[model samples]
Target: MQYIRNFCIIAHIDHGKSTLADRLLERTQTIHSRDRKNQLLDDMELERERGITIKSHAIQMEYKYKGVSYILNLIDTPGHVDFSYEVSRSIYACEGALLVVDAVKSIQAQTVSNLFLAIDRNLTIIPILNKIDLPVANKEKVTYEIMYLIGCTSEEVIYSSAKEGRGIDKILEAIICKIHPPKGNLKAPLQALIFDSFYNTFRGVEAYFKVINGQIRKGDKIKFMSSGKMYTAEEIGNLRLKHISKSIIRSGDVGYIISGIKDTLSIKVGDSFTSVNRPAKAIIAGFKKVNPMVFAGLYPEKTEDYDNLRVSIEKLHLNDASLTFFPESSIFLGSGFRCGFLGMLHLEIIQERLEREYGISVITTIPNVSYKVFLKCSPTDIFLVDNPSDMPDIFNIERLEEPYIKASIITQVNYVGAIMSLCIKKRGMIKNQYYLMPQRVELIFEMPLSEIIFNFYDRLKTISKGYASFDYSPLDYRFSDIVLVKILINHQLVDALSTLEHRSNAFYIGKKMCKKLQKIIPRQQFDISIQATIENKIIARETIKAVRKDVTAKCYGGDISRKRKLLLKQKKGKKKCSLLVK
Candidate 1:
């Protein structure tokens, strides 16, 4: 245990985090020559195509220091703000973290966000300035920024290029000397904390855990403390680049375990594993429940395939525990699942995986945030609503509250005005602003999660020319005046197109939605009356003209009386259609 070190690498997106992990693997020869590839830990197809890490990956390495063999467990974490939950889980499992910053870009929003998480856990911090070999690299400036953020001295910061594999040996030596190893009792009742897990077809669920107290061995009866389900350990081993099975995993070491548990919902992440023969008295603490920020509906393209979609999502949820979903139905889209996600990117990734990986054709509705409604009949009881169609009647409602967020944005000083304008347009209120550097500034805002869940990120990047970085944390819900906007086609309500928006912007958005639908909806035999309504009052309307058939076109040579008769017949048909619309 004294010779073992566990650490994780964290930074902002595209800030050389994955590159640093690649370099470390090469330095320790933990990965083989044939297996060496770019972003090695990001094994998913979507991750490679998008050039991002959506999940955290763990691997074990053996390093020799001063003729003594030392075991190192390294977890590579994602840098995006939407996946910060992954960073938090990884931080709790490790003893130290390498704070990687790009020499060219310096410290951004996510960099500061992840640093706080590691500090809150009291983990050892090793600051490294990466991308130093680039021609545009500003090594001294980035080093000063890291020192300011971490309160570390100049000599404490390491300058290196991850792409070029410089300063790898120094990083290893620092880990051995600076970071402490795991401390546990090998003779105590076995208590292992499961940090990550994924489903497999043949072997069942493969869970990666860290033994805290006693040893866990192959064929030992293991049970999850939360679920109280027991199973014999089919396999146990260290998590190298490849699976290396062993008979036993001792205390204070990281390893993987495979039991015959086939049910996807049976194994929950953060659950503790204990020996059935000598069970632990209590479960582990410090595991936080996930709080989703955005809510959306996912319906199958065909209603008959709903069961298949549910199964696919169940299997996928085992891999991504952050995703939460519940059954929901809409008059417009039929049966579907109302899903909650950390952010828009997380939602998009899940949608793509359902189509590409699971072969489930899906229809995604507009994303919204959860709300709390207090009714007149039950003022004390809070009614939670995520879908707009689920909102209570206007006369039955008492008070409404919507989720808000404390957003922190980092960008150049010149684009501050543009950013502030964009946020304000989305009903964001400015909170605090400060200068991180002479040219770089950080702005804080209090805004609705619903406002930013759609296009705030895209608009912010466009306004700042991709120089701005945004990160946010949930703030308590506040009093909000919002209305439900419902869309109707030919007097029939389309629940899928309904939305909840602030009363101030309700009319504008309603009109905009009507106009947008006019262009997309195809014309029919009768005129399509697209109307946006609020509380049974029509606020905006658009008309799509029907394709009329000229009944007298072939009667050009006929008598005047016959032509008049045809015209009168067509007029009567128009009146009948109008009466039916009413």
Candidate 2:
């Protein structure tokens, strides 16, 4: 019998997936007793600093219980909305999931969304109610609430405090007893599902996968199902706790393979691998290509650092596949790459890494959304518009459907009226409201994605006084008034800085972006006007005052040669204009 166990931990952001993984690593003795570093699963610097798992990390451990040595593969997946697609891929790699619900917070929108994904994948789910050791301990009530939402029996719920190391053994014991092992042909043709990949300075590309069938050994030739590219595996290995070790990953084993494939483009996160000797047909259903909802152009502040920017992006792609980039030149920014990302946090992470790791200073354009537009007299059109210069020429786009999200707010009942008013101001339509308890209520709203792009988060905090927790997921796009808002530098429409926004929220966003850009750009030689144009008509404008120190006080010539050199220096200063686009 194949004694393999595969499972993923699903939870809301900050609900302790990483912490639970740390406990699991400790209980399994993956790390030595002396190792004191916490959150061992989140090894990345960015992941540790952000206190969230950016990518799904896997670790394998061998545990002996009841005289049987069991192999357990634990996949720590992302909990944020930006990586929801990756979360799904992680789910596919496992036969069961351990849904970690915050004992105090109960069920959240992401928790519900992840549970639905697990159900859709037909994975056996074991819901664990965490945070019992806190002062507000209501494990029984939390268990009741989870069972009510998930339709599970009260007995199926497991309560624990992952932080204090309480009930961890029960969690592990439940995995062994309740979760089922893989049911596939172990000795058949090799077919491994590559869920995640990372780059090592010494090891090239490390592709982590779950072997469904057939045996994979060192020095075997393999092919990626999606890329159709062949590569020779230098070594096939499995994670012994956190370290990758050389081992024969047979059927029903969750492991990683190191191949000579150095280029990240050849190995995609959701790609499948098959043996050259016995190639199996690829199943493309599990991997859904993540479309970047937000777009931004990253420009090197120093023109000479363009190559460094490219190198940084290339390195970033080694681990982050959701980020897409294309060579783009702007009238104001000149040569740069327009990058698309899952959301604001994803964009910030990439930008911070580019500056910190690559040692390049960059100026990024305000992010905009991709829209689907339908002309009044022509066929449907789908394209991206970041700057106003890219707007369609004189074409009457009667209607457009921008994306919106179904947002849920869980707060004290006292704050419901305030949150409801805030939602209304953001053009949100209330769908449902329910009381989890007498004091806590869940407020559901369908809100346009544009409304939450900037300071909506800050606004929420201000209104709720940090008492409200929010979660949201993408809803279907609906028809709305689409306006093309273009940002202009010195009254000239900059094609690289335009955005397609809903008519209802265009002025607010346009004004907001102008403020951000104004704060970054230095005062110019002349008063620079920042304008927002809609359909070639200027709707908003902001003035940046001229720099007072642009001109230098002259000094009398000491020598004939010195006088000529001073004139030349003055001419060069005139060429270095402060206005970005004049």
Top-lDDT structure, candidate number: 1
Cα lDDT of model 2 overall?
0.79
What's model 1's TM-score? 0.96
How many Å off is the CA of 336 in candidate 2? 2.3
What TM-score would every model get versus the actual structure?
Answer: 0.96, 0.88
Score residue 365 of candidate 1 by CA lDDT: 88
Tell me the lDDT of model 1 at 388.
89
Question: What lDDT does the true structure give each of the candidates?
Answer: 0.90, 0.79
Considering summed lDDT, which 10 consecutive residues are worst modelled in model 2?
548-557
lDDT tens readout by residue for model 1, 16-120 = 888888988988988789888999999999999999999999999889989998999999999899999889888878999999999998899999999999999
Model 2 per-residue lDDT tens digits across residues 234-353: 887787755576657787788778886667567777778888988887554556677777788899998888987887787677677788898888877889998888788888878887
Model 2 clash pairs are 386-498, 387-497, 387-498, 388-498, 389-495
Give the residue spans of candidate 1 off by over 4 A. 550-552, 555-582
